[model samples]
Target: MKDTKDSWQDSWFDTCAALLTDPQNLRVWSVIVSLFGDLAQRPGDRLSGGALSRIIMPAGIKPEAIRVALHRLRKDGWIDSARQGRASAHFLTDYGRAQSAEVSPRIYTRAAAAPEAWHLLIAEDGAGQTALDDLLLAEEYFSIARNVALGAGPVPEDIDDDLLVFDASARTVPAWVRLRACPPELSEAAHGLLRDLSQADALLPRTPEAISPLQIATLRMLIVHRWRRVVLRQPDLPAAFFPADWPGPACRAAVFDLLDRLPRPALAELEAE
Candidate 1:
């Protein structure tokens, strides 16, 4: 009976892992970014190469692929590696940590944001176009058109003189506007993640002891990687901005449910493995 149960659990884990794997955006570097952001974004946190390999390799990432990805990330100023004797350790660089910090709140937030106030900034056709573009890039303003941008929360006190600004709220959201705000690809990705999370949740063993720390780490990385891609790309706009069928809220709920079940293991626990 013991052997039979073990076999069943092993098979279930393999299936769940397979279901969670995303081949479409399987860039090793991006996965590493997610892992670091999730587990090692702290000031002094770092992971040895062996630990990194163990955590990421279970997701079908090759050791050589990890080495290549690390090199690319280092070259691109997203990560830094140091060697002490024969062992090497990797950590996010300042730029990388900053980038990770920028999105960590949104990615890890348990509740969705509902901004109390909203505003719009409109630029003259040719006069303030460059300034508006700069604002869109530098700030969290969503671009509605070439000359108009929408922002959440209160209007800024010191506003740009070249642009016209208004404290606004949505009166009506048409299909065209909804499609523009939440594109088909974004919606598809959200639904796909929702399905994957649901399937994995169903297959996961009920007994938490059945799952190993390494397995937990690997699964968390996969979940966070896919979730990060979707959440970061899609702004946290009000429901009116999204189509009625948008799966983002559902996907987020599922993602957090799975994450709560698969709690993060300590760095020492991961490294010990």
Candidate 2:
């Protein structure tokens, strides 16, 4: 940060961060989650406050914001901090690690997870509401209507309600259904990320080696953070299940392409600089 004015003029990191950081909507706590999940999810991995600031400050987050976020995360049992002599180091708690691990596959996978076996669950109009709500937590279930849920894989055996199940395949899904499957707001986020990915990709150094490890970490955090929001919210279904214009496939491709170019750096490399 000492030479930030000069670095801004010369570094690709600033321009890419500018393009990727949602200033109006930037959530420091979420950004920290993305950072820790990407670089320090391992049990013993930690990021010292000094290194944390170096990586995040370039994204325009103030140190006070990060401090408040760290405090909130600690209070919520998501992170633990300890004194490391003159500086402090922070790492995820077991609960935090579990949460991050839960979503790692969806966040990191290069290929989409589309399954062929489809099933349907139906509930009595007003009586089985609780069962349906619980089932929605699993990735396989998608609420197609008030009383119905379409899912992948075998039907569950544990529900207590008088629920009906159907093993079905869709020969034809209507446009309205597809639109309902992925609403307009989700579509806009996907397209926005794709556009930013292209912009950030263009801003990077011509050769991968030219970028420092911290710079790589900064950009990767932004890419993965934005992507996590989009991918985790969209329904887990086949590409054909969504609208023909859905940007899911294209955005996924662009994300992995840029992330592959900026391969994740080691915690040691990131902290050292």
Best by lDDT: 1
Candidate 2 CA-lDDT value: 0.86
Once fitted onto the true fold, the runs of candidate 2 whose alpha carbons sit more than 4 angstroms away are 1-11
Candidate 2 lDDT score at position 240: 62
Segments in model 1 whose C-alpha atoms lie over 4 Å from true places: 1-9
Q: Relative to the unseen true structure, what is the C-alpha lDDT of residue 175 in candidate 2, on a scale of 0 to 100? A: 82
Residue 263 lDDT in model 2?
Answer: 88
* Model 1: worst 10 consecutive residues (lDDT sum): 16-25
Error of 2 at 35 (Å): 1.0
Q: What TM-score does structure 2 among the candidates reach? A: 0.93
**Model 1, span 77-170: residue lDDT tens:** 9999999579998999999999999999999998888897899999999867998998888888888889999999998877688889999999
